[model samples]
Target: MPRLADIDEISSLVLFVASDDAGYSTGVEFVADGGNLLGPVPAAKS
Candidate 1:
């Protein structure tokens, strides 16, 4: 589960990037993960 802040941050970032304010922006990957990167993972079965 992702936190509200993560979603909001991504949403705002996207809007800003799409607007003229981010005209000078280049290739960038916005990762909105709320510290979940260090959490556990599920097993993938074949």
Candidate 2:
């Protein structure tokens, strides 16, 4: 149900998205978990 990304991952993505390195980047959605949205499962075992 990963609603949030770890600091490192977010930092990396943010850097790239904001950098000239990602000049062509667009419509980036780091949807932490759409699977849970579709399934909507809580208390399911990992």
Candidate 3:
């Protein structure tokens, strides 16, 4: 199972994005998943 991200970790990202520091940031997608989409190493075979 993939380890879930801590609330603090996600919160920090949100805060950064909402802050003035991220003013120049645009057209971005923040993938907060803990590599869950990757599944097992080498990936699963059909």
Candidate 4:
């Protein structure tokens, strides 16, 4: 997704972390950058 993420998308993650569902989760990262860390996509071959 090259475009910016929706508010609900990021909020959902935050909700999960705050909820008991994420009780066991620790020492981890929660990335919400829409694959930006993967770098730009390569151009398609001709």
Q: What is the lDDT of residue 45 in candidate 4?
A: 100
Report the error of model 1 at residue 39, Å: 4.9
Cα lDDT listed for each candidate: 0.74, 0.69, 0.84, 0.93
Model 3 TM-score is 0.69
User: In model 3, how large is the Cα lDDT of residue 33?
Assistant: 85
Model 2 has an lDDT value of: 0.69
Could you tell me every candidate's TM-score relative to the true structure? 0.45, 0.47, 0.69, 0.87
Best-matching candidate per lDDT: 4
lDDT of 2 at 33: 49
Where does candidate 3 clash, by residue pair? Answer: none
For residues 1-46, could you state the per-residue lDDT of candidate 4 as single tens digits? 6899999999999999999999889877999999999999998899
- Largest TM-score belongs to which candidate? 4
* Weakest ten-residue segment in model 1 by summed lDDT: 1-10
lDDT of 4 at 7: 97
Better of 3 and 4 by TM-score: 4
Instruction: For candidate 2, write residues 1-46 as lDDT tens digits.
Output: 5576578876887787788987766776655443666775668588
Q: Sort by TM-score, best first: what order?
A: 4, 3, 2, 1
Residues 1-46, candidate 3, lDDT per residue (tens digit)?
4677889999999999999998888878877787777777676799
Candidate 2 stretches greater than 4 Å from native: 1-3, 27-46
